[model samples]
Target: MSSLTHTTTPANTPVERKATRSAGRRTSPNALLSKGVVNALLIVAAFYTLMPVSWLLFAATKSDRDLFSTSGFALGDFNLFANLHHVFTFNDGIYLRWFGNSILYSVVGSAASTFLCIATGYAFDTYDFKGKEKLFAAVLGGVLVPTTVIQLPMYLLATKVGIVNTYWALLLPALVNPFGVYLARVFSEGYVPNEVLEAARVDGAGELRIFAGISLPMLAPGFMTIFLFSFTASWNNFFGALVMLNDEKLYPVNLGLFMWNSVTQQQPEYYSLVITGSLVAVVPLIVAFVCLQRFWRSGLTAGAVK
Candidate 1:
């Protein structure tokens, strides 16, 4: 007994060291492969989306001879100005009219529609009305229905009401986007806290006053999101415009370009004009996005966390 010395070693020490080492090197080949695949898909998608726009940029700068003669991506003679002059002057400067029409439809329609959607969404969220969820479910169902499905019906109704072939035909339908309503409802739930609304109401604020003062300020991000969506949709409303308006004066920039492009089969000169018009048509959207993208992104992020 005197000759033996007791010794004890902790068994868990070795195991803990092993686990630490493994944790430090835990990145797996499968995860790396998945990341690589996702990156590759994103690159492919970006290329597909930008390819046409890149072609338009190059094509817009070329003259008729250069456009057909050179490669689609090749630099052409610097004829952007000449092309633009021709585009503006052709048909008594009708391009300007189209631009103006687009501004009116996009700006005014978006403003009204965004407010309407926001108000409806706020009501759905804050107030406990009968059939509210059912009504909202119906609106969601409307979003699944393709817009083209309703186009003909909307056109017929507009015709019956004598608003077809006018700005009202396109403008009115844009104010009724079910998707916008859904988006607004989601945004309201996220951004506009019920506690704030209740506090305002308890302070003797009327419902309209509460919405206008407290709720509306909180819902700014949603407003901008809906406005941009509505504006872009109205700006590119080619099919609806085609069905409703025969007058070139009422054409939006997109439809105007389409009409010009249709003539390129017989008249090659229209190619440069159409390309240039298309490039110009893209400017408003770019500007709107640049100015408002942060709001949209913030809204989305806020909604996600909520």
Candidate 2:
């Protein structure tokens, strides 16, 4: 028995050496350390992003006096209701009008923009037309050019067309998103298979009917993505509103809030109203993302499989 044990012990040495080498790797724990570092960075990033938003939240709850007196994060006299009352009742409830205007602009403009983008992209993907590539190149070039750069040109054109200072002024400009067209074309290529379109064509389906029945449904994710962008742009269209509109009744929420904020220097009481209005303005954007994000996420694999 003792001789056998001694012989077995010599054979176990290689296995033990292998185990020891693995144990040495355990000492570094590189993967765990990497996860810890990554987690730390994410926490820091989250905190940094949330800090101002946190301040906005707590500040919104406070009265005008508490806003000045208390630390930004500290809870103060809960004047949220009063602030809301002031916001809605001020200037014959003009804030509500502004809010409604924003909703109309965002909803109408985004929907129209999304539809136009999907159609244009679908056509670009499916059809061969005269100078199509050159036309698309021009559209791509439009993406490179900043919207601000064309503001003057657009303003002059709108003036010539007699659409300035109108809803058309805001909505028309939003309809021509080069980036949305680009995204739609990509989505069309991936989501709407050429084979499916060919099959529809073989069935004697018209182009419009095929798009409405099949391709549009497949392009749901692209539509939502473009809509979100267009909606946000229309909602926050402060500079455009500033340039085009002189009528307070036609003002969108951002421009309305800006008008309120501009007066805060003289009328300090308007400060709370401005903050509360700003908070309210953010709600639609949040709601939009929360509602549509699932569609966007699920689309990544929606057509990837069968």
Candidate 2 local lDDT, 1-56, one digit each (tens): 45544334575588899998888877767967988899999999999988877887
TM-score of 1: 0.91
Best by lDDT: 1
Instruction: Write the residue-wise lDDT of candidate 1 on 128-159 in tens digits.
Output: 97898999999999999988888899888997
lDDT of 1: 0.89
- On the 0 to 100 scale, the lDDT of residue 168 in model 1 is 92
Instruction: Assess every candidate by TM-score.
Output: 0.91, 0.87
Task: Give me the runs in candidate 1 sitting further than 4 Å from their true place.
Answer: 1-26
Show the lowest summed lDDT stretch of 10 residues, model 1.
Answer: 23-32
